[model samples]
Target: MLAGFAADLVVALHFAFILFVVAGGLLALRWPRLAWVHLPLVAWGAGIELIGWVCPLTPLENVLRRAAGQAGYAGGFIDHYLTPLIYPPGLTREHQLALGLFVTIVNVVIYGMIALRRCRLRQRSRGEVARS
Candidate 1:
């Protein structure tokens, strides 16, 4: 029972982490300091897709599920949980590449906006100082 609970907890955390990786830039837009934490997570998330690496959390969840007498799932967390919702069945290498590219492009656009906002703020501050 404890093992099952823990496995479920891991699944929740895994899902939350994926969300942060995909949309955490929005958080950084509000809290710029968060970008320090989010950028690394974004890199890790995209790298996993691009490199075809399994997240360690997947195996941890699987082990916990097995300990709870449940059958473990194959493939990574995204395959087990997200792919069905987002992509069609049978995720391929090309699909993985597209996912990685999607993640990168999303973050790049977000960070670009952040940079533009900062630049505008700096210019506004400079204009104020010049006028003063």
Candidate 2:
């Protein structure tokens, strides 16, 4: 029972960390502080994903599940969970790179828009100061 609970916690954290990486990028649009960590993680994640690499954690999780006598999934979490939602068939190397690119592109657009809006706000503030 204790081991089962521990395994559950590990799985939960694994899933939550995935969310933290993705949603965290979106949240960074509001809080610049996360950039210190999120920026590098985003780049690393995209690169790994684009290269069709498996993270070490996945194997570790599989090993644990096997010890627990559970059926371990073959691919990464994205393959088992996300692929069904996004694609009709299996996720290949191309699919991983595509997902990485999509994430980077979307985050870039979000950051760009946020920066542009901030610049406009600053410009307006300067103009008001000059007028005063």
Each model's TM-score?
Answer: 0.87, 0.73
lDDT, candidate 2, residue 36? 78
- Clashing residue pairs in candidate 1 are none
Reference-based TM-score, model 1: 0.87
The collision pairs in model 2 are none
Candidate 2 Cα misplacement greater than 4 A, ranges: 1-4, 73-89
Per-residue lDDT of model 2, residues 23-115, tens digit only: 676787778787678877777777778877776656665666667666743455644674344333677887888888986887678678778
**lDDT tens digits, residues 14-129, model 1?**
87888899999999999999999999999999998899988888888889889988884445564377534443579898988888899999999999999999999999999999
C-alpha lDDT of all candidate models, in order = 0.84, 0.67
Cα-based lDDT at residue 115, candidate 1:
98
- Give the lDDT of residue 114 in candidate 1: 97
Provide the RMSD of all predictions against the true structure, rounded to 1 decimal: 3.8, 4.4
